[model samples]
Target: MTTICVDAMGGDERPEVVLEGIAAALAADPELEVLVAGDEGVVGPFAESHERARALVTTEVIGMGEHPAEAVRAKRDSSIVRGCAAVRAGEADGFFSAGSTGAIFTAATLGVGRIRGIRRPALATALPGLDGHRTIALDLGANADARPEMLVQFAHMGRAYAKVVLGVEDARVGLLSNGTEDAKGSELAVSYHEALAAAGCGFAGNAEGTDLLLGSFDVIVCDGFTGNVALKSMEGTAKYLVKQIKAAAGESKRSAVGALLFKPALKRVAAELSGDEYGGAVLLGLKAPVFIGHGATSATAVAKGTAACAAAVRGGLVDGIAQALADAS
Candidate 1:
């Protein structure tokens, strides 16, 4: 069984809701082993409720609201640090956290280290696009600003992730830009356009924000600042669409009844579009699989995130990414 270490104290909901989600996930998959790293006092009781919760999961509490770097260094009991340590020590295959992203990123870098030749890691989030496939945007807050070479490296990492995680073979990659023309974006885009093209990463030229969800490419590459904005925009748009649909249905009794009749189908569609369904973002360019769950992620999200991490580890995504980067270099 692949062991996944979860930082139980990281999210806003902490041990309670996160525990509830873990219960739900374990109930769904009995064979999965989870290590809940958080306050044992809080997590212990919660684990006793389920038959296999205690048997399958072990609790190791870490302090909350502490400086991640200092905490990781000083507090050997801290959850995030211990969780990463477990993975590094071969006790677990992956680490999932909904806590402090900065701390989690920092801990992963310091404790787990990056793959060979990977300068810095990038956060890759999947966004729903045209057809059935998702478009992945990299550097989604990993590096605030990236050099032209870094952006080029992100493109390679993004392409490999799409192929392994999303099962896309010839992943199309586009540089985020203001216009479709090659000269549309910043000097970075202009500088890296030929680099991406020269690297032969199935380059799809420049893509605009308007075309982001229109399925312009399988992967989109940009610095974290722009990528984070684009990701938040997509998430906000999805939420607004759902709210609008709910409002439209409640406007009339007839519509309400219609919605009730199609509630299950609508819910299924909504769940698929929900950001949590994709199980947060993966910090690519690392030596081991690392998933950054949303701070407000539901138990379903945690469960799904665990599954995603397991798949990534089993697929050797880390080594594959390292090899891709080496080939690009």
Candidate 2:
């Protein structure tokens, strides 16, 4: 059975949405098991009633605003910490949290630990693309500051994740830069461009921001700061476009009537554009899969992230990264 440790008190919508997501995940995957960590008062009855669930009662909760490292050190029994501990202790195969990104990243790195020969683990997500394409991007928010060599590692890691999870046979890696030309981009990007190319980890050269969804590159690598900014910008732009479309659709009775025919397609596109397509970002270069969802994630996202984690575990994500890193070295 593939087991995942869940942080029940992690998200904005506490135990309720978390429980609902767990229920949905359990219903969907018969062989999946969960080690839910949260307050006894909240998670006790759910664990007792569910056949595949067990609760790890926690007295402390690391609030979203609290300092991640401090909370992790002080609140040893926090749900996030306990969940990572569960993974570290071999009680669970993966960790899933819709909590503070800092907290989950800190706890997972300090607790469950990084894979061998990895300097810094990165956050990656397969951005859904047009024409049935998918491009994987890395260092979403794990490390804001990274050296050129780290970009090399991110390239290899992104390539491996795309190959294993996205089923890309020969993942092409791209360095996110201002222009496709090697001479373009900041000093770091130029240096990373050179280092990534020399690393020989399928570096396909520089890619512009517009190329993210174009599927020209299978993997996009960058520092966490840049990647995170790019992701949020894309999300904001999508929301704006959706809002405008809705406004346009309602401007007149004739248009609204026409919109009725395409509402279903619009909804699907909105869902895809909302950045909820993947539900969570996969933290690569770790010993186990640690899925970090948005703090305000919905029940759908919770379920999707949990299911994705289970799939990653079954797909040998850890083994794939290890093999990729070994080969790169």
Candidate 2 on 32-91: residue-level lDDT in tens? 999989999878999999989999999999888999899899999899988999999999
- lDDT leader: 2
Q: Per-prediction RMSD in angstroms? A: 3.1, 1.4
Q: Mind giving the per-residue lDDT tens digits that candidate 1 earns over 1-329?
A: 66777777777765677777677767777666677777767667766766545322334433346666776666566677777878888877888888777778878987778888888899987877667768888888878888777877888888888888888877899988888897777777688676777777778899888766675688988889888888788778878988898999989999999988988998777777666788788898877888988877788888888778878887888878887877766
Q: lDDT of candidate 1? A: 0.78
Best by TM-score: 2
Q: Given candidate 1, what's the lDDT at residue 210? A: 70
Name the runs in model 2 displaced over 4 angstroms. none
